[model samples]
Target: MELTNYLGLAAILFAIGSATVLLRRNSIVVFMGIELMLNATNLVLVTFARMHGDITGQLLAFFVMVVAAAEVVVGLAIIITIFRARRSASVDDVNLLQS
Candidate 1:
């Protein structure tokens, strides 16, 4: 696929993910949205790597995948803890950290 097509798809996915993050109240939905955005970025990185016949993008994508994995693990743990503490998954209800 062409770079523009790859980038455009990435942009669209990023937008949808952003909208999900902004419009949703559930913590799990927000986490899914973040994953969606990361996957979209990963696709674009791989596409660019293929287009340029270089491994740099692939390496970056690999690292990104690792980070994303770690993020999900930690993020889910935090969310779960928060949910247990507050008994609500809605973002507005958990505001103990807010000043």
Candidate 2:
């Protein structure tokens, strides 16, 4: 497959993820959208790394994966806390800071 094909797929994935984040109200769904976006970015990085014949992009993708894993840990903890407090996981329901 050509590099452009990979790039196009990545773009599509990113768009879908962005739409999900914008249109969804559930916190967990939004988190999944964010993860999808991150994966799309990783795909682009890997494609570029392959095109350039270098390991840097792949290494960066690995770093992104590590950060994403940490994000999942912290994000899930926060979501679980909110769910326990209100029994709901909707983003609109999380207006704790609104004064």
Candidate 3:
């Protein structure tokens, strides 16, 4: 794939993720949006690595994916805990520390 095409797709994905984060009220959806943004960044990194014929960017993307997986696990766990406590996934309802 051309570097420009890859970057364009990354940009589109990032935009969609941003929209999801802004328009979705559910905590889980917002978390997924964050994941989407991460994936978009990884795509850009890998594409640039390919364009430059270098392995460093690809390696960095791999590490990023690994960290993203860990983040998803931890994020989902936290979301579940919050859902249990609030009985809803809406972000607007979360204000436990402020109370």
Best model per TM-score: 2
- TM-scores vs. true structure, each candidate: 0.89, 0.95, 0.90
Ranked by lDDT, top first: 2, 3, 1
Tens digits of per-residue lDDT for model 3 on 1-99?
557998999999999999999999999999989999999999999988998999999999999999999998999999999888879999889877794
lDDT score for candidate 2 against the true structure: 0.97
Across 1-99, the per-residue lDDT of candidate 2 in tens digits comes to 679899999999999999999999999999999999999999999999999999999999999999999999999999999999899999998887988
Predicted candidate 3, C-alpha RMSD = 1.6
The whole-model C-alpha lDDT of candidate 3 against the native structure comes to: 0.92
Better of 1 and 2 by TM-score: 2
Clashes of 3: 0
Give candidate 1's error at residue 3 in angstroms.
4.2
Writing each residue's lDDT as its tens digit, candidate 1 over 2-60 gives 57898899989988999999999998998899999998999889888988999999999
Error of 3 at 72 (Å): 1.1
Model 3, residue 42: what's the lDDT?
Answer: 93
Question: Lowest summed-lDDT stretch of 10 residues in model 2?
Answer: 90-99
Please report, in order, the local distance difference test score of every candidate based on alpha carbons.
Answer: 0.90, 0.97, 0.92
CA RMSD of each candidate after superposition: 1.5, 0.9, 1.6
Model 1 deviation from the true structure expressed as Cα RMSD, one decimal place: 1.5
Question: Which candidate's lDDT is highest?
Answer: 2
